[model samples]
Target: MLVAVLATALLVGCSPRSEPAPEVDVTGGAGEEPSLEYTPPLTISEATSEVLWEGTGPELEDSGPVLLDYRLQRADDGSLVEETYSTVPKPFTLTPEVLSADLHEALDGRTVGSRLLLLLPATSDTSSFASVMVVDVRPTRAWGEPVEPREGLPAVTLAEDGEPLIETPQGDPPRSLVVQALLRGDGDQVVEGSTVTVQYTGVRWSDGSMYDSSWVQGGPESFDLGSGVLPGLAEGLLEQTVGSQVMLVIPPESGGAVGGEEDTLVLVVDILATSAPAPDALTEEG
Candidate 1:
């Protein structure tokens, strides 16, 4: 869920790939530097319908969905705000229902690898007075499937019903596989527009100390499918028949948004439950 944490609310907010690696981030400071020249504000005519962005790599246009490498900053003082480098692309689907006409007008059909600065008014008194967001865009390949592994990471197989299959030896208490299925179901595995609930533990690829996990605390973690999680995990779950336990070895790139220093991330994930949204939930949105 890319939904901004507005005190206490989550927002749920795709694509294909290729090419040389993209550069990840930039460093800068808050408060203005005396000699540096800032780009002048463009007139509405100059802004046009095309979107401009900041990034390093080939510019992608008409590719399916776009992955983004970005750094948000303060416009006035040019201060660093936030940064993200992910294996998956962030989406920018625009529609009036989800975005205001002004926003759609600001970001439709923009080219990839461009850097854009969008100024937004603060929503409340406690927030900053204004915001300047810099975005770096890169489009994905249509129907973009994740890269298949040849080496580096170990792999898991899914059952006929799309649930992850656990290699097991008949034993009491099911010592090998957990009770719940991770990524199980009788339909298209890992649909883009769905929510999935599962339990998982993540370990550092290098030394194997746990960095993060929902399973250790007990209870499953639920998230919307195909929403910029590690591609391998999403794809692996899609192949399962719901209600089956599956253990997975996640390559650094496929395990989380940011690449880990370890060679691979090992996971024991159990798909605990699934819930499909109502038809209205499938509407095209920003």
Candidate 2:
């Protein structure tokens, strides 16, 4: 199920109290499933959060999508309600409209790789029981072991947040497709006809001018490898692993042209996640 935070309850006014925030013993490191230990029937007077561990990654500065692994529990009896750690991590936008005021305030200005503990008091609108949540911030970009590209390729540099900056080489673009891995990942290999989540920057090879970018678009994008994508892009991404950074040099014949005009395209793609198409989806494509 999608994670949803109700704001109406968070906005309810609270009276001042002398009691400190309830103690929630969180046991686990970042990137792993966490275990929560606390007394049952806990009572909270206000919404509060505590940073369990600090992160060293880039600071969040925008409302872009932030990936998170979290566990939510019922505070009245300490029973698990929902969690993402045993499965896939979920991405949430850090906007007031998307998250509760308390959640937004707690997550805002925080860096990636941080873990936080949140307590929400019972509200009349949604639930009569309080809620406890443990959140682990995950990186929004590709991260893996760096690999050096071969000579004569465009130079690729990274910003503090892992956004790729591409510099076209000094000669004519390659005649055929070129796929080079800038970072090697340890995840599963991307297969043909699968869906992929990626952050990418596309630029014209002739003058190094950018034409498209997922970073500029505010977040990563998901694409189906079976259709609606350039032939060169699909071919280059096949067999690549998740968590990898790849550079693809596409010639004009491979859907690299702009407005049917001959132009090579240089793309730096970060392979973040991939999943096989559903059985019905594959049948429909077939």
Candidate 3:
């Protein structure tokens, strides 16, 4: 039933004449019929400085357009409400063309990075009554650490320098990842600055299916170590202490793949070796 509703909502959302409605519930909870005239308040969760500057920063004498990346949460329970990282105005303009009347009245001339709590009055039958929203507005650079970093997992270990290495197979995969300990390193001959060569394999988390691998091709895939790879890959390889095995759960968005399906990816990599090739070696023969 929930899937049906979500599928319907997605279809409606893509309609040409339709406007995407914020996921505001008019009734507030499951099965409670909504009042005919209840409209929720409009709250700004996050915005780029550019949007705030043109829309609300006119009062500042030397304000340059800034970009805001923020996390919004529900004021009621503090549960994450929504993320507008890629919204049309993800880095939307505060210009006249982009600013809505509700925003103009609520945020015009407001300070950048200021947290604002506001209400949105519903305009129709489907709208909800005034609700609480917490907006943490900040410059675009503020977008950091999309996900909280977890401590080391027993199944996986990082070299002294923090690069992750997977434990060699003792028998079979563990039931789940187990917390281990933090790793510290000597920081010498580290995989930090130079291009480190390694082998890797990818598998589907849901069905344990192997999707792609550089190992199958025989030789380890040689990237400049850190260049041209996913953040997880870059971080994993660079910080990995020499000669360690690592397992990584790659989110779809970071995997350079099209996503919409609900599933995760598992990556197992072995740091076979690390070498800091000479500068001219880039053009030199292997």
Candidate 4:
């Protein structure tokens, strides 16, 4: 999901591929040293993106979601098309299927604080334009410390990226819900009433069976970490930091959001990103 309101698909005007690639210079733009520039060929048949500055931070992954502050301009008349410089960067998934083939190339091998210039020439299927993107490779989620199992509780394990592997333990289900952090992160803390993007999987501890998963649903989901969600999820996600993976083992009392009645509910949640509370929410509190 795009940050700063709904993901926008606004294109004021389309630039024809008839003209040569216009000269683009990001000199003194957005706190970056204005040293990067690119000029397009008069005629082109392919899409291309080049990194203006490979940020000095850790290298970013070729796959996964990435945040970017972007500025776009039409090549024909050099009119500003769109931008995210004033607001929070947008979250864009990096898979070739989620993004275009050429877009993946631009994000590939880039460092977290990198800057890039993508010049997609005219194509039979798409329009032509120049886009300047400042990539902010945020921290990836990680598995935290393991939670000690209670007597007769189900066993849980996680894959490298925080996917859970469950093995049901034989005994009566615990009477209350359980929430644990499998991994800890160093990002800003998640307080009550925050909004977040999370990757999660839900299952039944009774049979070690799967119920729902955000990963299988094509991507993680973004929502306010408040009453708008299931009781189990709302409570389970509370007070976790961004980039931390948590596990929630729920009983009937704390599992109403997921329709738990007789089954023992288990959830593995990765708190991927968090955003500030809405202005309206702040106003209401004040």
Give the Cα lDDT of each candidate: 0.40, 0.81, 0.38, 0.58
Q: Best to worst by TM-score, what's the order?
A: 2, 4, 1, 3
Which tens-of-lDDT digit does each residue in 1-286 have in candidate 2?
Answer: 4434445434443333467988889997755689999999888878777888889987876677787777888888998878865444666678766665667788888998899888888878756778888888877788879998999998999997789999866797889999999998877688877778788999998889898998888777777885879899999999999889999999988889776667899999988777665687769768
In Å, residue 118's CA in model 2 sits off its true spot by 1.4
Reference-based TM-score, model 4: 0.66
Each prediction's total of clashing residue pairs, residues at least 3 apart in sequence or on different chains, is 29, 0, 28, 5
Please give, for residues 110-148, the per-residue lDDT of candidate 1 as tens digits.
554455544443333323433344455532211112234
Of 2 and 4, the candidate ahead on lDDT is 2
What lDDT, from 0 to 1, does candidate 3 have?
Answer: 0.38
Tens-digit per-residue lDDT, 144-239, candidate 3 = 112233543224433432233444333233343321112222222335445554446665555555666654543344355445576656655555
Model 3, runs deviating above 4 Å: 1-190, 256-263, 277-286
Residue 256: error of model 3 in Å?
5.6
Instruction: Order the candidate numbers by lDDT, best to worst.
Output: 2, 4, 1, 3
Residue 128 error, candidate 4, Å? 7.8
lDDT of 4 at 54: 68
How displaced is residue 217 in candidate 1, in Å? 2.7
Candidate 2, poorest ten consecutive residues by summed lDDT: 8-17
